[model samples]
Target chain A: MIPALGLIVGIALGIFLDPSVPVWLQPYLPIAVIAALDAVFGGIRAVLDGIFNDKVFVISFLSNVVVAALIVFLGDQLGVGSQLSTGVVVVLGIRIFSNVASIRRHLFHA
Target chain B: MSSTTPPPPPTDPTRQESGWSRLLEAAKPRANRKTAVATALALALGFAVATQVQATGKQGLESLRTTDLVRILDDQTSRNERLDLETRRLQATRDELVNGSSKDEAAVKAATERLNQLRILAGTVKATGPGITMTITGQPGQVTYPTLLDLVQELRDAGAEAIQIGTARVVAQSYIAEHDGALYVDNTKLTLPYTIKAVGDGDTLQAAMNFPGGIVETIRQQGAEATVTKAPSVLVDALQQPPTDRYARPVPSASPSAP
Candidate 1:
């Protein structure tokens, strides 16, 4: 419940402050967000599976965001930025779908 | 969410205790602090996600200052207008240059043709064609300058293209002079036998010479012999080096009545 309230407040603050992303950082944000969501859903799933660990969750979340941004940055330098970003999105998207499915089963048993 | 603890006896959030108290009770001090840290991390993650969503939600330029955006738009519009004007000016210049070149080409061709014809007419080039040659022989004083000039006039009227008499090319400026019962064509004195080479139509020139009241009858009356022969070809090899005009230049523009 605290986490949910925190998320809501964060969204409200975003709407109020209206912060803009820098041009240099814009390319990797969506990708980093997807990676973060993947980590969050993984943490939730781990909780449901009786394996929740705060250290693992924090480490995984950091690694996921960093690795996703690094892959896109490297791809940009190598002149394959868009294609590599698409690849990252596809993998992370599949993970999110499965985790959300698991979350649904845990929450509603449907 | 289920806890990684000893199974509670099928407990749910009831009127027994608050969620925070229950959560703290369920964990040791170390686990409790970890849970609090997790909640704070979740808050940060949520903030990051919200910012990302806002940033990507619409046009990337939405974050720019109004003044900066207006400046950029004004700059782009003026640049586009300038480019359009430049394109039109270049196209017009190209079209004018193309038309000028085409006109210059045709003018050059016509002028060259006219120059060659003028060269021939001015006796700068050799003249050749089928025509008649007239030879006049008379004892000392019979063949006079007036008779010779009249003969030239008659041949000119009959459309003689070129005429040469006794090493003298008869052009527009040529004059026949007689001094002391002697004839001179221009500065060259004529000998007894005067042969005139004329390039023209053979039959027409020959008939013109023999007509009544013509130079042939006048020469016969003058006790001189005028013999006309139609040749397959008559060549006037004399060329005139016309002096350049000192005080005359070509007019730049044609008069209104000029064809």
Candidate 2:
């Protein structure tokens, strides 16, 4: 419950800070940085359950970095990079939401 | 050959949850999936409420000047800033459309017809295969109207068949004005270091302005502003107008004279 609540609260605050800020600055927000902290929490959960995989963690990290940079670059070229950066954050947002949802389900499953 | 999937990882407490169970026991009613989902949803709802409340509150406090109402005042000011930016962008688009479209179709058609007659009068539809260049610079402080007008007149007297100021075409009838301290050429705001180009005879145009107290001399006295030069290949485009209706009749004249 705490993790899920944290994820939602963080995203809400992120959106509220500059709901209309040029999309480019979206991924750079402290909120997104904090949201990425979820994978750490997930790693913790996995280690506790003896199911940690270094490969999965590494791949996820690499993909996030690549996608974020690519969005910014493409946006800069097309004159919509700021908006596209916001889109990259949205992708991160979905991941955070789903991870929280799954953790919730895992914890509460009778 | 059929391939068998690898078995799921072992859930041995010895390797995994050594201290997690103790932590879980200390924190009773640790949220299950459903409870966690509910909590997340609640948090989302709370944030939405707070955001809306702040927005409406800011709008309400715009007229108030209470010393303690700093937050309210700042929000209102930022909102206004965003609105002003949007207005400027829209205004630019509107000007682009207006300047692009046909202004006086009938007059343009008449002008074109008159040009054809003049071509017959001059015995040729073409002006010349060579021209001169007129480099117009702003005054030391800023580029203003009188200077711009003088430059335009000089180009005209120099027998310039084509003239372009900055990026805008110098049509037969174009209006240039300054609004809110920004200089606009043909209703389009120009950036600094304005350049005006003219296509005409180099020698004839040069000789025409060779007299003392000419445009170049006047501009030079004004300090670091406006220059005119001759070019080998100055291309002037004959401006075209949108087609007018062929069978349209003129409006009946209102006879206001003493009858």
Residue-level lDDT tens digits of model 1 in B1-259: 1221223332453612342343334333343655676667666677777888777677566554344577899999999999999999999999999999998898889989988778767778888999999999888799778889998888888889888898888888889999888888878888878899898888988888999988899998999999999998999888877768999998877765345
Quote the positional error of residue A107 for candidate 1 in Å: 34
In angstroms, the error of model 2 at B231 is 1.6
| Model 2 per-residue lDDT tens digits across residues B132-156 | 6556555434556676676677767
lDDT of 1 by residue, A1-71 (tens): 55556667777777788777777777787888888878877876665554667787788877888999999
Question: True contacts preserved, each candidate?
Answer: 0.31, 0.07
Which tens-of-lDDT digit does each residue in A1-110 have in candidate 2?
A: 36445546755784567343333433233233433344444443443344545555444434444555666666656766556767766766765565555444445541
Which ten-residue region of model 1 chain B has the weakest summed lDDT?
B1-10
Displacement of residue B259 (Cα, Å) in model 2 is 36
What is the lDDT, from 0 to 100, of the residue A4 in candidate 2?
Answer: 48
